[model samples]
Target: MLEIKNIVKQYANHRALDDVSTRVEQGSIFGLLGPNGAGKTSLIRIINQITAPDSGEVFFDGQPLSPDHIGRIGYLPEERGLYKKMEIGEQMLYLAQLKGLSKQEATSRIKHWFEKMEMQSWWHKKVEDLSKGMQQKVQFVATVVHQPDLIILDEPFTGFDPVNVNIIKEEILSLNRNGATIIFSTHRMESVEELCDSIVLINKSKKILDGKVREIKKAYRTNTYRVEHLSHDVQLASVEGLFAIESREDKGENTALTIKIAAGRTINDVLAHLLPIVQIHELKEIIPSIHDIFVQQVTTKASNPLISEQE
Candidate 1:
């Protein structure tokens, strides 16, 4: 539903974004990931039209992004911005109307959201009177009341307790299930693993990785496997084809081992030799986590110019 094409942005002495391009599909949760000062916020601003890129273009729903598209997009910035002195109900109503909802419609939606979020008693309380988490809830309500087609959330779980975080997470997933395209930006790799259908990782003002989460993880696999076997006297410590024995744990009467296979040896090859030595209980591949891939990519880009260019 959204396409960012070779967007470039520069400040006086630094390039914030350099030839970054990625796409977010319709009704999908897309993750925009990067560390601090990695140009993620700069790109988000460009998408929200809070700032223009130095070069390139953004397209929404198969057309060039325009002013009219603003009403179809909902943005919840990393930095919270709310009228501190305004009552919760009043602020949400005003913001919803500004997004093109009629006054009556805004009020009805606000009431429904408040009831759903269990904030009915806090309606008349000013934003300043609420806790950070409470204020965050209010801002979230304001963001989605108009039911925009695209919702861009930056650090959306900030200031939320675990309970409230789960609540918002459920809401975000519900929104996606109801046909909203979501762009989630955060440093939480675990959240990306759980919620994002696909992800784009940016570093040093460039797009480093972009793909379906499962595909990316599978692409980065290192042929690691975890094995559990019923063995009390077996000591196959000098396995020749093993790259490394990552870990060994004693589980009751059996031993569990995580081993990495050397190049050119398959898991079946390893199992063939192990089955004669011990009764195999369970075996599973060790999939790389998103954090592992992020660190590996960033480090590789910084150290290897050829790899970076090829990537």
Candidate 2:
């Protein structure tokens, strides 16, 4: 639904986005991940047309990005943007109309969302009167009330308890299920792992990684496996060629081991060696989490070495 081609943006001395490019597939949850000052916001701003890219092109739904596509995109920025003095319903009506919604349609959607969010009593309340979480809920309502084709969410889970976070998360999923392509930008790797089908990692104003979540994790796998077995006295130190035990934990009656299979060695080889010595209870390959992958990639490419690994 969205294609960013070699987008470049600069601000005075620093380059916020440097030749960055990625695609957001239609009806899919795409993650835009990075640490502080990693050019994620710059790319997002360029997509929103808040600032023009120094060079390169962006295409929306097969055409060049332009003002006509503005109403088809929904953006919920990390920084809250609400008129604190205005009534919740009134403010939402104005924002919706600004996104090209008619008065009657905007009012109906506002009512539907307020009722869905159990905020019916809050319609007449001013933004200044609500707590931070309540205000976030209102902003979320404003974002999706128009049901745009493309939704861009930045740090969308901020300022909310777990319950409310889940509420908003479910709503995001519901929106995607109904055919909205979502670009979810956040430092929360767990959310990316759970919600994103594909992701692109940006660091130091460049695109570092991009692919399906499963495929990326597969590419990073190192043949490591976790095993839990009933064997206290088992010793594999003498077996040098099959595998290397990375870690071992004792659980009273059982022992858990993390081992990396050596070159030319297979799971069957490790099992063959262990089956006689221990009664295997559980065994599974250890796949790297998105958090681990994020840190590894960013730190590996970082020249500063002190970059914040904000997974």
Model 2, 1-311: lDDT tens digits are 99889888889999888887788898999999989999988888888999999999999999999999999989999998999899988999999999988999999999999999999999889999999899889999998999999999999999899999899999999999999999999988999999999999888888888888988888878899998888656655526788888898888888888999998989999888888877889999999999998998878853322232332
* Model 2, residue pairs in steric clash: none
Clashes of each: 0, 0
What TM-score, computed on C-alpha atoms, does each candidate reach?
A: 0.94, 0.95
How far is 210's C-alpha from truth in model 2 (Å)? 0.8
lDDT per residue as tens, model 1, 1-311: 99999899999999999999889999999999988888999998999899999999999999998899999999998898999999888888889989999999999999999999999998899999999999889888888999999999999999999999999999999999999999999988899999999998888898888888888887778898888888675865747755468899899978888899999989888878888889888999999899988888877654322223524
lDDT of 2 at 85: 92
After superposition, which runs of candidate 2 have C-alpha atoms over 4 Å from their true positions?
A: 302-311
Which 10-residue span in candidate 2 carries the lowest summed lDDT? 302-311
lDDT of 2: 0.89
